[model samples]
Target chain A: MPKIATREAYGKALVALGEENPDVVVLDADLAKSTKTIEFKKRFPHRFFDLGVAEANMIGTAAGLATAGKIPFCSTFAVFATGRCYDQIRQSVAYPGLPVTIAASHAGITVGEDGASHQAVEDMALMRVLPNMTVFVPADAVETAGAVRAAAEAGGPVYIRLGRSGVPVLHGDDFEFVPGRAVEMRRGLDATIIACGLMVAQALEAVEQLAAEGIEVGVLNVHTLKPLDVQAIVDAAQRTGAIVTAEEHSIIGGLGSAVAETLAEHYPVPMLRVGLRDVFGESGRPDELLQKYGLTADAIVDAVQSLL
Target chain B: MDTEGVVAELAEKARVIRRHIIEMLGEAGSGHPGGSLSAADIVTALYFKEMRLDPTRPDWPDRDRFVLSKGHAAPVLYAALAERGYFPTEELATLRKLGSRLQGHPDMKKLPGVEISTGSLGQGLSVANGMALAARLDGRDYRVYALLGDGEIQEGQVWEAAMAAAYYALENLAVFIDYNGLQIDGPVNEVLAPEPVPEKWRAFGWHVVEIDGHDFRQILAALAEGRHTRGQPTAIVARTVKGKGVSFMENRVDWHGVAPKGDQIVQALKELA
Candidate 1:
């Protein structure tokens, strides 16, 4: 499978959106090159604003531009995009329900070697709790392109989480991404693995491996965290009887907690969460950190096995 | 109107705005009165004389923008909006009430004529910068104005925005610092002195202007200077008295966020009348 970083896809999509919509503008906090928004800057210099290393200002400015009928895409590292400017996002963007897209890059432990400070393992939790925010964690480059387009077309505040490292493309060119709808990668009966972001790819691999062992498990890609497809989760739970959630984020408030909340209220099923165990990420290679934090395909397999 | 007539009309409007602020705060029983009262003249000048706005067309793209960065003074903004006919003046008493468009803080979505929702200090200037940038991008000549509190500048984000505004050379942006000297804790000088405020803005590459905030002529002149200035943004440091027009509350720290009670309200209205 071809590989491309989600941030790269985001950059390409932004350039295309700028061509289609003259009102589209981009803002970055001195990380345009890292976040891949420099591409949009190159294409639309007049519409791109490098706000220096100020994330809070970038967010508030984006809200202001939205008020002026400009669709602004504010990009920065997820750590700074969500945590550093959470109050600004809540007050300026979400409170007004502005049509601004917060395209946060380098999300989760994939931002390796930069240590805990750079890795935004709890970004989804910070954004999802807001009143009028739509959170998207695309599975790969293809889905990231679709997610960015969706956010640009959908008015109101949308947060698209992108990874720093390249992941295998799991969707084809014809794949269509519908917000709040989960895509079932594979079907089975024994257990279901619900995941988002980079974990969806790992869950797909785990499903293949589990199938080799005569264990039939399903993989459900929950790309949109907020406005989660509770109906899909319920259908998967009814078909598989057990549930396991996987993500490259904290177990407390990412995919696991969202799925658990859905099932606990509607279906009351046994489950296991596979991700960071309420601990911070450390300096290491992306693969090493994934293994150390039990975020590999084998971890998903183990989680499914534990639930069964 | 002639200059004298304009100043007289604006002065009367400022008085009426102050009356509205006091009555609304008294009805709500809690709000930032000192800052609201202090900002009356500046806001009144903008809404009534300076800003090009149509109350019926609140979403006019080319209209000048005003952001109340010191958003706790929402009573002043709401009063000005009502007096400008953005909404019914009767709605002024619904401040801070359940389902009232007039929230304790300004909510742009809930109220008309509110360019940006601001309650958290130090965030509005950045929003104003964005609006100015948008105007430039769209090739429109609309100007953006932001009002910041003296103590609110203590937030590091304000400096970040200050630096960016100068870097962008936003000639269309004008910021006003209501230097009333008192904050919720105490005197801003005693709490955390942001002394030499004008020099700080000048060092940040802005055209600094100092004026008496209550003087309508000075306020109008400074705004005109800001408009004519080129290459960089302008910062107008308006030295104002906290709780202006109300003798019992003027410059007194206790009235910073307190609503005036029965006798106090009577005295405040009497002084304004």
Candidate 2:
């Protein structure tokens, strides 16, 4: 499978979206190149706005454009896009149910070299708690493109978290995406491994490794974290009787927390979370950081084995 | 647009809006009256004399937009919308009550005429800039007006939008700094003043205008000047008293967010009368 960063696919999808709908406008807070809104800017300069390193104003402006019947896509690093402008998103976008797409890239510990300051490990928690916000953490480039389309069609605020590192494409080009529904990648009787974003690909590796070890485990790719596919999770919990959740975010508030909350309320199961513990990421290569933070396929296998 | 009869009509409308502010705050038992009262004339001019609007078609795409960036003063906006016939005048009593469309802040989804929801300061200018940019993008002729509080500029996002508005050369956008000179903590100047406001907006490439916010002719002329100016958004710095109409509450910081009580409401209504 080819490898492509989700941010790359986001930039391409935005260009295609702009071509399809004239009402689809893109705004960037001076990260046009890194966040990949630069391609959209090149294609539709008239519809593109550079808010110049001002994430709060960019978010508020996106809400304004949404109010005027425009589907505005705002892009920046996850740290600035969410943490820097959380109140702006809450008041101006989510409060009014504006159709503003906040496509934040460089999420998780994988935002290498920038260290803890630039990475956003709690963005999903921040967005999921909002009343009108829909959160999406796509697994790969194909899913990233589909998530962008779904967010554009959605009527309210959406936070699509993308990554900086290139990830293995786990799905085919013709893969169909239905938002808020989990895709069961593999079947197993022992336990279910649920994951989102780039961690899904890593979990696939864990599934294969567990299968080779005379153990069986299922993998559920949960892309939509806000309107979670709770039925799929409950069914997986029933079918497997144990659960392991993995993500490239904080173990405290990201996918692990969401899945834990769901399973605890509906169907309780022995679970192990694999992500960053209550700590911060330092400047390092993406692979080294993943290894150090226990966010790799090996970590998922360890978590599932621990549950057993 | 500022004929003698029209000015007289707007002045009366401002007085009526002020009365509604007092009455609504009195009923709600806890809502902002000072800023709402301070902005009565400017909001009155926009609703009655300046901005183009149709009461029945609140969703008219071509209609001009009014974003109350200083959303704490929502009573003034609700009063203007009601007086403009967007809703029944009697609904003013339901300002902050449960099940009412009028929220404590101007919620665009709940209200018909509200262009965007805002309570957090410093974001309205950005939203207004977005609206203005959208107008240019769609080739629409509608103008976007945003009213920002004097202290709201402290949020830092206001200057960011100020710079972007000028960068985009948004001629159809006009923002008003409701320089009422008072905030909750105390006088705005005494507590982290965003003073030299007009000069700041000017430095950020806005066409600057100063006026007594309570003056009808000055308010109208500034609106006209903004419309006549080209290639940049206009910043109208209106010097205003915090509690403009009520004698005892006027310039009093205590009234900034407090609702008028029994005797206070009666006195405020009498002074307006």
Candidate 3:
């Protein structure tokens, strides 16, 4: 399978949305090239606006456009997109329930050499806590495209988290994206690895590793973190009786926390969360960072094995 | 324009809006009276004459839009919206009440004619710019107006919007900075001054217009100037006294966020009446 960055897929999806929906407009914070919004700019020059490194202003402006019946997609690095403009999102977009899609690229430690300053380990947490926000951490390029289209159609405040580096394709062209539905990658009776974002790729790898070891472990890709697929998570816990959640974010407030809270209430089971554990990431290559932070498939396998 | 007669009429409207502000704030028992009172005239002028609006169709596509960036002054905007018949005047008493459409801040979802939800300072201007940009994109001729407080400029996002509005050359957008001279702490200049206000706006690529915020005619003319200007957003530096109308509250910093109580409300109502 070809490796494609989710940000690249987002740019393509934006152009398609721009063509289909005349009301769709794209706003970026001067990181058009990095966030891959340049393609949208090239195609729909009139519809694209570079807000000049002002993420907060971009959010407020998108809120305004949404007020007047225009669907605006705000693109920026995940760190700046959520942290810098959280109040703007809360006051202008989430509070009013505006149809503004925050396309946040360069999420997680995979931001690599940029170090912890540029990484958004808590972006999903920030967006998920907001009342009207829909959070999506698409696993691969194909899923990213489908997530963008679904977010645009969902028509409220949405946060789509993307990565800077290319990830292996995880889904087919025919894969449909539903807002709060979890896709079951594999079925296992021993344990299950529930993950979101790029970590889903690692979960699949872990499933393969566990299969070789003759330990049946399933993988559930929870793309939407805000309107969490609670039923799927409960079902997974019931089916497997042990679970492990993996994400490219801090274990405190991403997929791990979401799954834990759901299980603690509905179906309590022995589980472990595999991700950054309160420590900040250092500047390194993407592959090296994953290995250093214990965010690799080995980490998922270990967590699942411990849970079982 | 029947200048005296027009001013007299809008002045009456302003007086009524001011009365409503006092009454509502008195009822709410906690609200920003200074900025609300300070912006009553400019807001009154817009709702009464300057902007093209239909009270019946508050969401009309071509109607002019208004955003209260200094959203703590929502009482004044609510007063104007109520007076303009967007909602019933009796609902004025419900400001900040539980489940009231008139929220503590301007909530577009709750209230009619509120173009965008704003309470945090420095965000409304960007929203106005978005509305103006949308108007241009959709081939509509609707204009957008945003009102900012004197101290609201201290927020960094304001300058970001300032740069963006100018860069976009949003001719359909006009903003009013209610230069009320006082914020919560103390006098604006003494507490992190944003002085040379008009010059700063000019430097930011806006067609700067300074006016007495209380003057009905000047407010209208400046808005007209904004309408005539091309290739740049206009900024009207409205010189206003904090807590303008009420004699006791005039230019008083203490009233910045405090609602009038008992005798204060009585005297304020008597003065406006």
Candidate 4:
């Protein structure tokens, strides 16, 4: 079986969308090669814009294009897209409710050799808080492609978080992606391990390990963080006595925070969050950082065991 | 458009806009007056005489668009919008109050005529550029306009947008600079000078125009020149005086954001009358 990264899916989807919609435009802030928007640029030179290290202007221009009824997909490293140009997104895109799809690539520790500075773990949190903003984190390449299509079709602001490192193609190519729905990957009764992005693979591995120990650990892939499926989380919490949420972000405000917020209001249960704990990531290898930062399969299994 | 009669009408509108700014600031007790008063005539000319905007249909697709890049001076734009019938003129007194759409800065979601929410300086031009590019891609004939403050131009992103607009030869886009010389800290010469603004814009490949921003005839004439220019974007460097109408606040840094007291408001309105 072949494996691919989520960022590649973004590039593929951009080409596909560009072929279909003439109003679709691609913008890059000097990372066309890295973010994989180069494919679309090559195919449709007129529709592609290389913004040259101006992320703020890139986002604002995307908003502007949307105002003129054009769907603009802006691609860049997640750090610059979310952290550096946050205000531009807030005022220009989100506030006006423009249909701008921000395809943020190289998210989280999975970005590997670029180290902590390039990896964007806090994007989910930052994008989630903005008014009228939609957040989606795909589990694999197939799902990322589907999310890009969904964002393009959806008439509003959407943020698609993608990764640089290659991972298993768990979902088949024919799998249909929904914007605000969680996909139940495994069935169990003991505990539910909700995960997103690359963490889904770790979570599945944890479930397989826990099954050997006679623990029926369930796994759920929560791709959409905003407009979250509150009922699915409540039902999962009801079916399983405890829940373990894992993500590549700070525990203070991100995927874990969104899950916690929903469960607190609707359904209360014992929960354990496995992610960064009020500390900045340091320069290290991808796998080393995952282990050191407590984002591995072992960490997920431990969190589930602790919750039980 | 013949600019002679239009200039006189816009000049009178600019006077009323200035009066509106002072009165509203007095009611609010705190608001930017310097930049707002400086930009009154330029914005008034765009809204009343230059742009093809329908006050009734604030979201008309074919209508020309304007983005106030320097948004702290929203009072001027708001005054112009009210005068143009985007909203009621009497509601101007409710500026910056709780539950009012008239926020301290422009909020596009809350206000109908505001194109983009701006306050954090140096981002609006990029947004206007986006709109301009969108118009071209969509094959729409409507042009886009943006106004910038002298002090706000100090932000590097403004230059980034400047370079991009000229690089694209966005002939449908026009930018204005309210060269009032005064910012919050002090005179721009004392704080951070943006001298030879027209030369800088020309160097960036834009069709630069130097005009007396307060002279409504000159402002309209420059705008007319921008319309016929075919190859590049136009930047009108409108030299203006901060707090152009009010006697005490003119050229004074202290009046940058401070509203006048009740007695002062009476005197200011009297001057306008």
Clashing pairs counted in every model: 0, 0, 0, 0
| lDDT string, candidate 2, B1-273, tens digits | 338988899999899999999999999999888899889999999999788999899999999999999999999999999999999999989989999999999888888888888898888989998999999988999999999998887888888999999999999999999998888898888999787888899999999999999999999999999999999999999999999999999999999888889998898899999
Model 3 CA lDDT for position A53:
79
In candidate 3 chain A, where is summed lDDT lowest over 10 consecutive residues? A299-308
Every model: iRMSD = 0.7, 0.7, 0.6, 1.3
Clashing pairs in 1: none
lDDT (Cα, tens digit) per residue for candidate 4, span A146-218: 8998999889999999988887888986799998999999988999999998899999999999999999988
lDDT per residue (tens digit) for residues A138-233 in model 2: 999999999999999999999999999999998898998898999999988999999999999999999999989989999999999989999999
3 or 4, which is superior by DockQ? 3
Chain A TM-score compared with the true chain A, each model in order: 0.99, 0.99, 0.99, 0.98
TM for candidate 4 is: 0.96
Query: Which has the higher TM-score value, candidate number 3 or candidate number 4?
Result: 3
Q: What would the per-residue lDDT of candidate 3 be over residues A140-250, giving only the tens digit for each residue? A: 988898998998888799999999999999888999988899999998899989999889989999999999989999899999997999999999999999999999999
Poorly placed runs, candidate 3 (over 4 Å): none
| All DockQ scores | 0.89, 0.90, 0.89, 0.71
Estimate the overall C-alpha local distance difference test score of candidate 4: 0.89
Model 2, residue B90: distance off in Å is 0.9
TM-score of each: 0.99, 0.99, 0.99, 0.96
Per DockQ, what order, best first?
A: 2, 3, 1, 4
All candidates' chain B TM-scores are 0.99, 0.98, 0.98, 0.97
Candidate 3 lDDT tens digits, B88-181: 9999999899999999998888888888888988899989989999999989998999999989999999999999999999999999999999
